[model samples]
Target: MPLSLLLSLLAPPLCLACGAAAQVHQPLCGRCRGGLRWLPPEQAGAGVPLWAAVSYEGPARALVRALKFRGAVALADAMAAQMAANAPPGLLESRALVPVPMHPARRRRRGFNQAKEIAAALGRRCGLPLADCLERPAGAARGSQVGLGREERLSALTGSVRFRRGAAVPLRALLVDDVVTTGATFAACAVALAHAGVRDVGGIAYARTPGR
Candidate 1:
């Protein structure tokens, strides 16, 4: 048997949010999943138009924390499912999914890029192609944007993100991220893609920080 299958038999998966037993394919228990506060169709107007699946509060917040900080990568699929379902009509169709790039040092320390993982799963569910064409060069300074304001973030991220040297730039691109707080990240990414010849750029995230 595969090692993953054997491990599952020995110790069943547990909910990342509440620690209750969960199915192998699911990261949250039914109750926690049901508790997510689904948001109405709303867009953050900071940079490019962006849609979110749920408010970044309660179970939704917990799930994002688990996936981003606790290494519970399995939750990406569940988060992506919600994003795919809640996406605006025609937003995902015919557009390449571009995961917001992470700084290399941060990605190495975290062992993965949560945005990329979420975007990968979202692509599979939405029938979109993954355009891993954006990147943050190693020369750029890396800092936490946790407490920064929108303008502050934009200033700090300026010139830090760029399109890869020779990757195929899609005609239309939809930026993907695990969370959208002030939309600075999406804006920065959209700018990079636009400079690289992508005509249309939009964004989607699993959760959006409430009140931003």
Candidate 2:
């Protein structure tokens, strides 16, 4: 933990969603995790199968908002753990966990990549290496993830997220992210992996949409 973050925890910041004092250095209170909805990967639609740890409502939603919008990088661990909780057996046994990358401009404006943070945290706890799966170039940075059709958006998104070419090793990967609304982002990352000769890529995330 950063010195500033460590000091902040000693004092204990008040939770935004609830008035309770947060014991964890991250954004959530103990009660919050309970209110969050969790989904397993196999329950998802036809696409890159996703493992969602919590729902997008209640405390999980609040925590995700705090991390993605309020610049709270510290909350990644909670999300990572929750995500790992319901991850596929294949992912748990995999050697690498790759984060779906954000465009540079958006990342710069946000001041952090929540997916990357979650990916690193997941890798640490799961004892796997964290890999970078996608990189949005100079132009493609913005989109309404909600409006896009799962298949269409997945088809249009980052198809060429280059990893190190010609590195010699067996390839079994698990994609990591903060959440999945449409299957778009997960599918995009899956496509990238497929291009890289990784035929089967599993996914894990903080949470997933309940329907569709």
Candidate 3:
């Protein structure tokens, strides 16, 4: 049997949100899924049009935290499913998905980049290509963005993100992240891609902080 099937037989899958029994293919129970506060389509207002699957609250927030902090990498597929389903028409067409790059030190500590995992899953579901071309140069600030205001986050991120040297820059790219709170990260990445000759840039996040 497949490993996933064997694992399920050994241990039934549980909801990542509310700890209820869940379907093998989904990480959230029906109730938690229904409780998700979805957001309408909106631009990043940071020169990159962005779409988010849900609001960063309640079960949605729980799911993000589980994936980011608890290393529940399997949840990436479930999050990507929502993003693929709710994405605006033509958003994925001919566009490369570029995950927001985590600093090398932080990635080492976390063992993986949550945004890259989400982007990989999203790319599979959307049938799009991924452009893993962005990076945070050495000496860039690696402070957490949590609780930081928009200006503060932007200031810290300015000149911090850049496209990898000699990597093929895509004509149209969509930046992917687990969440969008202040939009500073997306804006900073857009600037980097633009500097690298990317003509069109956009963003997609699994969740958006309310009122952001």
lDDT of 3 by residue, 1-25 (tens): 8675687789988887788999888
| Clash pairs detected, candidate 3 | none
lDDT of 2 by residue, 91-199 (tens): 6775577777877878899988898898898878888887665576656645665576766665567553444455432287777777777767777777767777886
Off by over 4 Å in 1: 1-4
Question: lDDT of all predictions, in order shown?
Answer: 0.87, 0.70, 0.89
Cα lDDT of model 1 by residue, 1-212, tens digit? 86655777899888777899888788788988888887777576575888888989888888899898878676798888887777778887999999999999989999999999998998899889999999999999787888888889898888999999999989999999988888888999998999999999999888888887
Q: TM-score of every model?
A: 0.92, 0.84, 0.94
Candidate 1, after superposition: displacement of residue 166 in Å? Answer: 0.2
Better of 2 and 3 by lDDT: 3
Instruction: Please report, as a residue range, the 10-residue window in candidate 3 with the lowest summed lDDT.
Output: 39-48
Model 1 accuracy (lDDT, Cα): 0.87
